[model samples]
Target chain A: EAGVVQSPRYKIIEKKQPVAFWCNPISGHNTLYWYRQNLGQGPELLIRYENEEAVDDSQLPKDRFSAERLKGVDSTLKIQPAELGDSAVYLCASSQETGWGRGELFFGEGSRLTVL
Target chain B: GESVGLHLPTLSVQEGDNSIINCAYSNSASDYFIWYKQESGKGPQFIIDIRSNMDKRQGQRVTVLLNKTVKHLSLQIAATQPGDSAVYFCAETKSSNTGKLIFGQGTTLQVKP
Candidate 1:
């Protein structure tokens, strides 16, 4: 089966500009996640979706970041007025909803963003 | 804020040697842990996983040991190969359902061939 797929494997933007990333989860997967990995840091959770409803987005920078998972099959993450510090690799992952504890998570080749 | 971090930033090992990677987590509520391997420009790929209920789980040439008491986790790779070179990360989930994982800082493994 095809793994999770993401668009624009890389992106470059000036500080204060806006950018968006897209993700398509594996077929039949019910859970989707968005994570940001800064240089030398772990991937931090930005949001999570179970179907079309966002179950966890507290970590997302609401002031400038927003996400959507319409139809529960795909997701999009956006950042406006991007900061230099915001430059990082954004990863999209998916898993079957049977429960993350049992099944493994699959990730896409992340979208690397560079802010100039 | 809870976090997961690796003890080493990098690990160098001989091609035939075993490699062990360690991680420390702060969330006591976390009940599941996973180890992932990521090549440069690629995303993290699952290597192995263990639940809080079990202390050790083994998979194809890899083993994951979880210590809920100390909030420590370890991944051991047997007979490491050059292809094993990558950044390794340990991730934890507080619950079994959300599937939202909190990843570690990651350890770069360099297999000396």
Candidate 2:
């Protein structure tokens, strides 16, 4: 039983460049989440997907940030024309639909984005 | 969402001693609470959880205390070790299936050997 996998572990780009992250959830998990953790701060939810349907994305910056879970097992988060403020760790997590939003989550190491 | 600063409150304790990390949440409607441990260069991992109906829940060597009246939460680590050094976060969510969690400013736990 492998845990959630994300790549690449790190990325460095200049401001206004485009960046993308990929995530693979654990087997049989029906819910996936993307969270952003700024320096020294707790993670904040960016979007949540339930079997390919995005149930919550109010916190995502629609203008520059977009996400998709096409097949329901893997997910991608994209930032177009990224800003300096976008530098942070992009974390992907997954849980059981049975727990819905109330269960334990397994997380990946996360993709660290550094925008200069 | 709660405002977070770059500097987090830190708790230091000696190894083999008890450790208590406290968090104050603002949402009274939040019924589900969770504690997460995050090490450097890693995402958060769940430690323990408590619902509004319950006040205490214990795990292998950890305990979570929920005070619904004041919207407060605490995680207690018994016989702390150096491996327990990490940033601890407390998250709350309103009752639903969205899994939208509001996280507080994390507390850094430094266990001294």
Candidate 3:
């Protein structure tokens, strides 16, 4: 039973460049989430997906950030024209279901992005 | 390495000592809470969780205490070890969001070797 897996453990890009991060959640998990963790701060929810549909994305920067979970099992987060302030760890987490007592989110080693 | 906030409230404990970390949540509707341990460069790992129904829950060597009255939560680690040192975060989830947890400001635990 492997945990969530993310690709390109680390990434670096310049300002105005586009960057993308990928995530693969745990098996049989029906819910997936993408979070942005800034230095010295806690992880903030960027978006959440239940199966292939995005249920929550209010926190995501719609003008520059976009995400998709085409098949529902894997997800990708993209930031176009990345800004210097966009540097942060992009984390992905998954859970068994939605409801009480099922709120434990299993997280993957995040993808760290550095924008110069 | 994640830069420590200008002045992180630190909790230093001697090896083998018992440690307690506290958190305050804002949302009253949040019915679920979780404790996560995040090592350097790694994602937050679940340490333990407690539902709003129960005031306290215990795991192998860890315990989570929740106080709905004060909207406070605490994580207790028995026989703390150096490996247990990391940034700990407490998150709350509303019963409606299914399980989207709103995380706290995080606390950094420093275990004195």
Query: Which segments of candidate 3 are over 4 A away from where they belong?
Result: B1-8
* Docking model 3 quality class: medium
Model 1's chain B yields a TM-score of 0.92
Clashes of 1: 0
Which stretches of candidate 1 lie above 4 Å from their native place?
A98-103, B1-6
The digit string of per-residue lDDT tens for model 3 on B15-105 reads 8888888888898888888899999988999898887889999998899999999888888899989999999998888765656788887
Candidate 2's residue-wise lDDT over A10-63, tens digit each?
999999999999999999998899999899888899999989899889999999
Candidate 2 displacement at residue B73 in angstroms: 0.9
* lDDT digits (tens) for residues A1-116 of candidate 1: 89999988999999999999999999999889999999888889898888999988989999999999999999999999899989999999998863644647788999999999
Off by over 4 Å in 2: A98-101, B1-8
Question: Which lDDT value does model 3 have at B103?
Answer: 88
lDDT of model 3 at position B69: 95
**lDDT, each prediction:** 0.87, 0.87, 0.88
Listed in order, each prediction's TM-score against the native is: 0.93, 0.93, 0.93
Span of 10 residues, lowest total lDDT, candidate 2 chain A = A96-105
TM-score of chain B of 2: 0.91
Name the lDDT of candidate 2: 0.87
In terms of lDDT, the best-performing candidate is: 3
Fnat of candidates, each listed: 0.78, 0.65, 0.75
